[model samples]
Target: MQKSLHITPDKCTGCLQCEMACSYENYQVFNTSLSRIKVFDFHHTGKKVPYTCTQCDEAWCLHACPVEAITMDKTNGVKVVSEDTCVGCKVCTIACPFGTVNYVQETGKVQKCDLCGGDPACATACPTGAITFIDSNWTGLDKMKQWAEKLSNQAHA
Candidate 1:
């Protein structure tokens, strides 16, 4: 089954453990800038939202890559960028609607979330359970449940 990380922004505490873990796993460093996952801090709303590649079914990155560096891993449904195959082209970065795919000058290649080879370090490091590895088919389950609860409350009222 395909796996995905569900991030509940409301539960996030802005500790940045997820960013640190992602960077450490991929680069062996604690630099948030190097991390594929980024946490956006909304100071006005006092909120933090951890954002990363959504692993789109029809990934623009995969198609935009001229050298075929980006390909979909059928097993996990992740769009993985092969550094060796990449020609340092920034086409994929521009194709991504969410801007999750980014260019790395140090490596002269692009990077995005690879689901950590099916074991996401960011999800494991999240202290508040804001990030959870779950079945991709059920990604909308939480939102469905939340709406169901709200409907029930309205019925009672």
Candidate 2:
């Protein structure tokens, strides 16, 4: 049973603990800039939303890499970028529709959330229960789509 990160933006409080944990886990530092997960602050609305790679099934970033640096881990369905093979061309960054794939200036290689090898640090560090690792079937994306469809129907009524 594959698990996925289920994110609920409404529960986030902008504390940025997720970012700190992520950076620490991946880079051995506590720098938000180095973290793969980002908390977006909506200034006008005073809301915070934590965002990261969803690890899409299509994985446009993986497909766009010229050197095939990114490969899907079949066991867990995570798209992992091989830094040794990556050329830092930034094509994967461009191909990523969600802007999750990023170029790390220090390493000159691209980076994205690899689910922390299926134990996501960001999810574990989320204090408000905003992020949870759960079964892929219950990721909440399907519910969001249904809600959007309902709104669309109401709009057309």
Q: Highest lDDT: give the candidate number.
A: 2
| Model 2 lDDT tens row, 32-95 | 9999999999999999999999989889999899999999999999999999999999999999
Q: For residues 38-145, what per-residue lDDT tens digits would candidate 1 score against the true structure?
A: 999999999999999999988998999999999888788999999989988899999999999999999899999999999999999999999999988884777799
Candidate that scores best on TM-score: 1
The per-model lDDT (C-alpha) reads: 0.93, 0.94
RMSD of 2: 4.2
Q: Can you give the TM-score per candidate against the true fold?
A: 0.93, 0.88
**Model 1 — which ten-residue stretch has the worst lDDT?**
134-143
Q: Candidate 2: what lDDT?
A: 0.94
